[model samples]
Target chain A: MVLSLTLLFVLSSGADGRVMHIKSLFASPLSEPRVGAQRTINLSRGTKVSVVTTQDPWVRIRFAAGTGWVLNAVLSDSPPGKTSSLLDSGADVSLNARKRVSGFTSAAAARGLREGADDFSGSKFRPDFESVRNMEGGYVNPDDGYAYILNGRTR
Target chain B: MKQHVAAAFFVLTALLPVAGAQSGAPALSRARAHQGVISTEEDHGDLTAEIRFGRALAARILGQYKLSADDKTGGYVSRVGAGLVAMSGRPEIRFHFGVIESNEINAYACPGGYVFITKGALSLMSGEAQLAGVISHEIAHINRKHVVRALKIHGGGGSFASGIAAMIGGTSDSSRVILGSLMDRGMDLLFKDGLSIADEFDSDADAQENMVAAGYSPAEYRRYLQKISDAGPGKTTSILSKTHPPLAGRIERLKQREGRLGENARN
Candidate 1:
């Protein structure tokens, strides 16, 4: 009885510490919250960190390497590389099957959820989805983005 | 008696976190909430619905304004936007950036992750940072789900029919009518009523944060807004003036944020 109670206590208290993951393609942890501060290491996306505190746009976090500051926008509650596949596969399954399986998809048909916005296509003007797709297709490589940042081209 | 003690201890320990979180977690809670990551099955359905809605909205916008044929310009804008997206905390929805042929100094963001800047808006930007500021603001709107919330476009499974039902608090049988009505209203929201001033200000603040995170100057956003404000009653500025709050107010807020952050930096 004591052991079971202790396990329950541990599980319940665990929610107190929230883990945030790096959302940016690559984030360099700074020694301070300010921009132009010294950076010791680059953390890749989805790297988990325990947040210590926040100063609005910046968050101080503790990771395997050490404690450092990263921008708040560079963190998310969800793990990276999980959402897209979930959405895609979920879309492929028929609405009826999904309804039988889960409440999430049970009302999908009633709600008009589909893989893409193709169902909403009866606008007076022909929707230029082709162009939107073309735009989506042309992703800027992450390496190019890093190069852009390194060069301070935007600065 | 010992078992009773253990049970009581377990309950107290479990409740402690809840009490502590209630006392000291507003900021963290707000951040987690704003991230809006799809964590549950319901969120998954809502997000899928949001994407579909956004795609249709993008199509409508594209129909109204032709995409700029200049690949180089489009590519440059895409690259800058990509950097902002990296820092946006919304990796689930792949953002697509494009340049439209309109000469108006305005940018539009659809619910999903579609962003477009007008050629005139592009011309107004002095450099890539300024462009980042602009794109970041639009990205902020999408990231924050401003349109989605305003339209009440989440829940009720996933179709426009059900979304419409949710919005109107009634049922609709015709999918076509439902979708068309929703699209028209969304268009009106973008082109007519505009998002609430609070939403605009929130995006401005978020834009600054995103800019700084992406290694760009938030001041550039201030400068761009100032430039547009100074340009005055021209064709290029007309749409923006209607769709956004006064530039002076936005600039003042940005300056205040800068001052606060600067103080933090000093401390």
Candidate 2:
């Protein structure tokens, strides 16, 4: 147990110093805070650079031979050991699916508990077998199909 | 009556060349002969005469445009434009440069030393050499007398369509009718006409010659052209396309003439 716990702590610390990759070029014609003409930089197709600092929409990065600031919108977290193409394509899909499933389960449990309870006494007690089964099997919810369809993860 | 007097004065100026040959006015005779050809008829002339008239006319038209003659901006423009002009064989003609207030990206020259460039044109230029490229082209127009000769050929009517109408002598009313038809066509000619392509090529050639003469790299013209081209088509057709040469063809011509122009840094 101690060995396992130590390994987990090391792993958690390792994840803290993650490096962010710059995905876009942002330049303003003037050095002013606003009213400057902004343009995108597209140096290469798969170029990678790390962020040194960020302030809202602007981020400064160190690129080959120099450092410059780019827009924050042009960047995304670089996934571990994966090429940018795969990370970009799969990251949003998996994250959205997981969030939808967890949200649905919690919502259904709360609705079932509320509807089955008659008073404070009943509410404090465990739900009946039918109520528990109905909630778990998706019978307590008439909108499960609709939710799945809307979430886009049903297929 | 005033117009008649002006015409008589012009004629006397033309005849003075022949009448003064036996007198001690040989230099005046030569000056009159040069002026006669420029005044009596309009055609591109030898280098020295074109340079003289280009400097003179540029000054007059630039004054008419009400451009500021303040030494600050005017001095900067003349310094840059003259450096480029000096490369075109160091002609004796003075160079006059002016900045216009309009937001349009345009630069053009009138006869005799006038070059007017808009602030909008300056905003678009990325560097000093790009400005040189544009000014050199306008100087070529003065040297070629493209506008004045076209005006004389077309009877002082505004544009190409009017020139065509005047050539046929359809009617005084016909000139008005031609002017009406030109409202839309004129925009096309002014904005996308092919003559500009030829002018652009000539200017590019002249600019290359001037750049080499000034001891700057001629390749900068190519680089500057690429930047303007990359800025994408302007809001209207590029003044370059409308009043100058096709970019791709001019670039290719510059490339061909690259070796003959004096050597300088490539970048």
All candidates: CA RMSD in angstroms?
12.7, 34.3
Error of 2 at B60 (Å): 10
How much lDDT does candidate 1 score?
0.69
The digit string of per-residue lDDT tens for model 2 on B112-190 reads 4456777777777766667767777776655544443332212221232222222221224433333323222222222
The reply for model 2, stretches above 4 Å from the true place, is A1-155, B1-71, B89-92, B153-196, B236-238, B262-267
Local accuracy of candidate 1 as per-residue lDDT tens digits, B114-202:
89999999888888878988999998888888777666676444342333334332223344445565677677667766777767888
Best by lDDT: 1
Interface RMSDs of the predictions, in order, are: 5.5, 39.8
lDDT of 1 at B211: 82
Residue A81 displacement (Å), model 1: 5.1
Alpha-carbon DockQ of candidate 2: 0.00
lDDT of each: 0.69, 0.41
User: How displaced is residue A25 in candidate 1, in Å?
Assistant: 1.8
Q: Model 1, range A1-155, lDDT digits (tens) per residue? A: 99999878765444235688887777888898776678979998889888777787677887888878887777887676444421233332223422323432333444444323344443454687656655655556444654666577535
Candidate 2, residues A1-155: lDDT per residue as tens digits?
99999888656444233244432121221121111223334333124555555432334555564545543323335411111110121222223424533444455344332222211111111213222211112111112212322242233
CA error at residue A52 for candidate 2, angstroms: 64
Cα deviation in Å at residue B171, candidate 1?
A: 15
